[model samples]
Target: MQIAITGTGCYIPSITIPNDDFAANNFLNSDGTPIQHENRLVIEKFKAITGIGERRYVEPHLNTSDIALLAAEKALTDANIDKEELDYIILAHNFGDVSSGQSQSDTIPSLASRVKHLLRIHNPKCIAYDLLFGCPGWVEGVIQACAFIKSGMATKCLVIGAETLSRVTDPHDRDSMIYSDGAGAAVIEAVENGGKILSHATRTFTYEEAYFLFYGTSYRPTAKNTKYIKMYGRKIYEFAITNVPKAMKECLNESGAGIEDVKKIFIHQANEKMDEAIVSRFYGLYDRSMPKDVMPMNIHKMGNSSVATIPTLFDMVRKGNLKNQSIEKEDVVIFASVGAGMNINAVIYKV
Candidate 1:
């Protein structure tokens, strides 16, 4: 069985916070020069390291659901399908409506019912649920969607990776600069031909190692204190450099595709350095002849949207920026991500 992403869409918050405003708000140098104060220096260092120039944050009144709804609507419309045609709605979110109480307590069915009412999707067979993983959520969700269709459980699925990281960011912390609010959606349909999810591979290194990057009730107590997403930068960098390439190789081996067969690689836009490291590793393995192109690191423009990264790239590709450098219909595109769980996943697609 095969699944193709027939529709793709994304929603970025309306508020655009420029780098200068960010620097000023945090009381730091605009060019990220080292400030005298240790805290200020850390903030500037974050800006310098992540290369994030601007980011969008939803208004305090808005939530992930609102952003997700917008993207989901666009995706459904793009696929020329109504909400009523959807068999399942799987939301991949690290953050949800705070007004709905605790994160996990806010059931997907309840949220989906509200969304259904708002969108008038009166399909009784539609089952909605939430799946929370780190950045690998979208890849995993797509894999699961294919399984559901293969099992005859659902014919059509709306897999959405939506995040309002702004809600979890520690405003006082410099790390917050690399987080933004956004959502992306894809309509996965079981199809025989055209852009099928050919194969996927995933691995977990250590749950303890994964705990280094996280956000939740256990991590923070109050909303006012949740303005930054913290990370052990050096540790994450080391992990990505070591694991991403290995994961990609394993995926290619499992899919029966050599590294040379891939035309483009869409990696999680976590950091610029991470991208360079992965590409370097890919070249080292393949004699430096198989050049792999990656999506323009949007971290400078949109920060890290966590799970939303891949699907956002999918939307961008559909919009005309992400494409094979060589340009061939059968050229392979490899999607990979290494997230907080210390987990890595890769999927191959024939464009």
Candidate 2:
């Protein structure tokens, strides 16, 4: 049994906020005054480090599941598949259906369940659930789908990564600059003759660092403070740059492929410098100089949407949304991500 990505789709907000816009509109503290940070310096350093010039945020009325439905609709339509034909809906997210000013998540029915209802998918056999594996959730979902297909347990599956991170972001904090909102979906179906995932690996270091703190954890438990997402950016950057590349190389070796065999790499849009360094280190394993054109980045246009980044970036390149980048048939591509849970995952795929 083989799994082929039949279609891919992503939904980004219409409103694009530039770095200058952030510099102009300062986020005020709880004391009703602007937080202390040199706007010009922060903007400059942020752009220089993250390669982020602009990012998209949805309107106040939109929720997490809304963009998910839109993305799923597009993906299903692109695949020419009907709702009833879907065997599973795997939603990758952290915060679910959180409107503006609401920090708490509503995962009672699961975001995938809400999306199925909103999409009017009434097939009783179609199971829906949520996966919270940090930034690699979407890729992990695809991996799970592959298992289901290859095991002959399912025929078709829809994997989605949708997040409204702006809801939990502390505007007064610098981390807000890296948080955005979006959704991306892919339709995976069993195929006899098509490019498929060859091998993949996932790793987690829950004990090494507690970078992101949520409610009920020992790090932060107070309802008032724990609602917001906080992180040690420096630690995360170091962790990602050191670990992701090594894991990617290991996963590549598992597939009997080399660094030269990869045509492209879609890494999580966390940090520009960090991602570049990771890819460079991966190439360094074989004493090969890093190729500039292999990694396509959209962090300049799309901030870290957590789990949504990989799928969105993949769809963008696959559909010719990016300049001078394209995923053709028979091309070998790699996807990798590292985030919140300090979780890292990589997949070697043939397209």
Candidate 3:
């Protein structure tokens, strides 16, 4: 029996917010001081480093669980499986369902439970739960599902990564432009013939790295006690470049696949420059130059949706929606991510 992802789907929000749209934002320094650079200059520098020109936001009426349900339905249709057959439903995210115009997150029922309810699956045997592992949550959920399958505890599982970062963003924070809203889901099962998961590795660093990303007050002093997603951009970049590549290399080596066999890599869409640096260092370990088109990035348009980025990009590429990026049978690929917990994880798969 081979563990595999049978179907995948994603929800890309309709509302687009361009970089120019942020020009009017009253941007402020973390210390509540005025920025010397103009909004245009700041945006240009941001675009150059992160490659994000725009991002999507959910409709006023929609929430994280709502989009999750949409993606789950599409995944079920693509898998052609009975929802009741699923033995587990795992939802990965940071903030829960933050309704539009609200600052607080709602996670009482758990996003996984909410998705299961929305799917109308009444199977009590189908365990539903939420996982908060920073942006690597989805990848970690997939690994957990594989563990269940391997240990004879489950036959099938549904793993989803969803987030509505727009609701928790601070208008005064420039880093807010890097956050967006999206959801992605995949059906995992043991198959007689299909793509297979080879190996995976995960790590969490709390030694002075735990707060690389966190919730903090707005840059504006008068914004009160309201919290928003904030990060030490330079610190996170340094942490990721130093640690992510090592985890990826370890995962690839454990998979027993040669470096030359890798055809594609789906990494978290945090920053374009940081991603490029990580991949470059990874290949350098094998004494080879990074190959062209080995990585397909959607950050230019999607920004960073935290846990949702990798699986969403995977769905897009699988459906042939990403130009010049596709996978084939027996192809070796890697999925990797880094985020708030200072967490890092990587998975090697054969398609």
TM-score of each: 0.85, 0.93, 0.99
TM-score of 1: 0.85
lDDT of 1 at 281: 89
Q: Model 1 misses residue 116 by how many Å? A: 3.8
Q: Candidate 2: lDDT of 23?
A: 71
lDDT of 2 by residue, 1-351 (tens): 578899989999887988787776455544446556778887888889888888899899989989998899989988898889999999999878887777668888899999999989889899999999888899999999989998888999999999988778765566678888999999999988887888999998888665543422112222255456667777887888888888999999998877778999999998899989999988988789888789988888999898889889999999999999998898999999988787989999999
| Candidate 1: regions farther than 4 A off | 25-48, 99-114, 216-228, 289-292, 321-328
Instruction: Give per-residue CA lDDT, model 1, range 256-306, as digits (tens).
Output: 777767777878878776777886786667666435354445677877888
Answer with 1 or 2, whichever has the higher TM-score. 2
Model 1 Cα shift for residue 60 (angstroms): 3.8
Which pairs of residues collide in model 1? 169-226, 169-227, 169-228, 170-227, 170-228, 171-227
**Model 2: what TM-score?**
0.93
**Candidate whose TM-score is highest:** 3
**Which portions of model 3 miss their true places by more than 4 Å?**
none
The best-first sequence of candidates by lDDT reads 3, 2, 1
- Model 1 / residue 190 / CA error / Å: 1.2
